[model samples]
Target: MSLEVTVVQACLRSGRGGSRTAVVEDGDLSDAARRTVPGAVGASQAVFIAAQDPAAVRLRFFTSTGELPACGHGTVAALAVLAQRSGNDRYDGVLHSTTRSLPGHAIGNAGHYSAAFEPGPIDLRAATIEEADPILSALRVSAEVAGCHVASVGRPRLLVELADRQTLANLAPDMPTLQAVTDRLDLLGCYVYVTPSSDGHTVARMFAPSIGVPEDIANANSTACAAAHLSTRGHSKLQVDMGDSLGQPATMTATVTGSPGTPIVEVGGTATISGRHHLD
Candidate 1:
């Protein structure tokens, strides 16, 4: 069987360099990720699309290892392709994944688009100080942590706050140990961030080896979780700088509304269309 695929780099900084994603229109193919992802497109994640209704489209994300409950950058890439196919600068649709339903809206034309989505009902919990020891050990860093917490938007991520941006940028995680800790805690990955700057920009990094992503260029799912966690501490709008540790530099924009307990968050940024291909 053959299928058409479009690859886009989402959450780019200065309209260049971001996470590479492959978007495939929904068809009869099963186990699509194992078939095309990382091989045909050389993507970190793959999105399978199916029309749910007249107003929305169902999205499924997969890595080289397995399917994910939801994916932020993948969603943006999928929506960008969908809107371009429909020839509409502004499009509205629902992103239906196995465990979530998100409302997605996108703007701009082909090869360049901006996407935003509302990830509903996130669970935030504080990770005990004892839990921090394992993460610090896994990263091979000193015990100079500021705080630690866990956030679950669509996937679970352990959020670790370091002493400062310098410390955050100087991380070198032991992949084997990180994978072990992720397995023990049943987490999707760990999101490490610094304290918010005066301009409300937070520099962060994401490391997820258990799910087959060693380090994400720009993570939208966990960043929203981070934003929700920040909302509790009296910050609403946040601009996150990620991927610097990898030299692929990406940016993420997040805004949280309403109260801390009941908050609505949107993670969005511009994306560039890299290329497209087909699989057989």
Candidate 2:
């Protein structure tokens, strides 16, 4: 048996550069096969597109660690590939993860594709200065920053505010302690950010020790959660600059609609096909 896969880098030059390789498979990919394929291709995540439909196609994502409940970048990459391969200028698809089903849409041609999706619930809970002090201390960040809060979409991520973009960029997180905090709180990881200029662009860095991704290049879902948090505080739409710590930085923009309590968050970004491979 043989499987064909297309590799894609999502969020392009913005945020932390990341890729999702979509495996063109006919039937369900076994758990072991799912783990083996991505690892063999040297990709952090993989999306398997099966049973295609013009209205919506079935898609699933996996990582070296295990099957993910949902993946924002993975969805974008899958939809982009679908559009490119099918020669459709636009497409609507359903990305079925292990735990949730998300609707995805994409527009573009060939190597350039823009994709968007409605993420799951986003809730922002205020975290007091005292509550976040310990974590900041662990990360060598100060507690004086104003916008510290915890944001939860499908997963919980600590959104910490810093004094400036430079500080956020210079971060060197203590992975051991950071991992402990994420595990204790059952969080996916922490997203540290700051608004340096008057342009209102929020620069950020995502760290997830729980999943062994010390620093995620570009994290779409978490960035959407940040957008929702900012919307609750009066900012509706903004560019989220992430993954600057890594040389291959990427940028993404997110928008939030409706009231703060029930905001609809959408994350949009471009994806480029990086490579293609086959496995048997």
Candidate 3:
């Protein structure tokens, strides 16, 4: 298949885009970086990257299975392009992105080199023991999880609040077993969160062994907002740190009044562009 790609050189600042705006389309996105990064198509295929800004980004990888809801790295790359195109303070309004605009669930903002797109604020609600079992096994998260809930915005993330930052950072799941479990259960992926004893920001890691993407996502925009959306009901200001684990170490900040169920959830952060390229 011929691969269609749009490359942009850009920067990202903060506070931009709503929840369903901004998009980029790549005719062919390979799964090379899957698992190592938070988001992206798992196999070689056509991909659509859409964002809501400073908060959530969703990716629909048209696959044999169906349209995959979210992709992390692809979101980062798209924001890089948006940021490069519009530099400076917040950028709003309906603008043409690298890909064609998607109606309903698409809107966003731009910054120096950073862009944040929101999705329907992350909502953490209920889940059954059977639904939660696979995740526990996948992350090798043998112990029990507190404040566990079914979370989603762009992509479905099983939010598991660990005991401490130690457990959050030290996620050692059996990839083979976890993947088998999630696939059978029909889940997109799993993300674990933890609040530090004393904080600057929130720390989290995602494992989607089922879809074949492993641990480590630099900074998944959608997942970042999802985590914040879950915390706002009880806390204020969520700072997310996902460094080398996902390839690019970055920070995402979310401030709002509710978690997932709130009427509104806004997320913002700095996005830095590595560079640009013209696909061959």
Best by lDDT: 1
What ordering of candidates by TM-score runs from best to worst?
1, 2, 3
What's the lDDT for all of these models?
Answer: 0.83, 0.74, 0.49
**Ten residues in sequence with the least summed lDDT for candidate 3:** 10-19
lDDT of 3 by residue, 167-202 (tens): 766778888877777777666667677754345356
The 10 consecutive residues of candidate 2 with the worst lDDT sum are 14-23
* Model 2 residue 70 lDDT score: 67
What's the C-alpha lDDT at position 225 in model 1?
A: 89
Q: List the residue pairs that clash in candidate 2.
A: 13-250, 14-250, 14-251, 15-250, 15-251, 16-217, 16-218
In angstroms, how far off is 251's CA in candidate 1?
Answer: 0.6
Question: Residue 29 in model 2: shift from native, Å?
Answer: 2.8
Which candidate ranks first by TM-score, i.e. highest? 1
Q: What are the per-residue Cα lDDT tens digits for candidate 1 across 1-280?
A: 6777788899998976888888877777668444456556778888888874656578878888888888888888887887787788887888788888888888998569998898888898888766667877898777488778989977778998876887877788999999998888888999999878766698889999998888989899888988898887788889988988787888989999987788999988778778878776
Per-candidate TM-scores read: 0.95, 0.88, 0.66
List candidate 3 stretches off by more than 4 Å.
Answer: 1-67, 86-90, 94-112, 121-123, 196-200, 219-229, 258-261
Full ranking by lDDT: 1, 2, 3
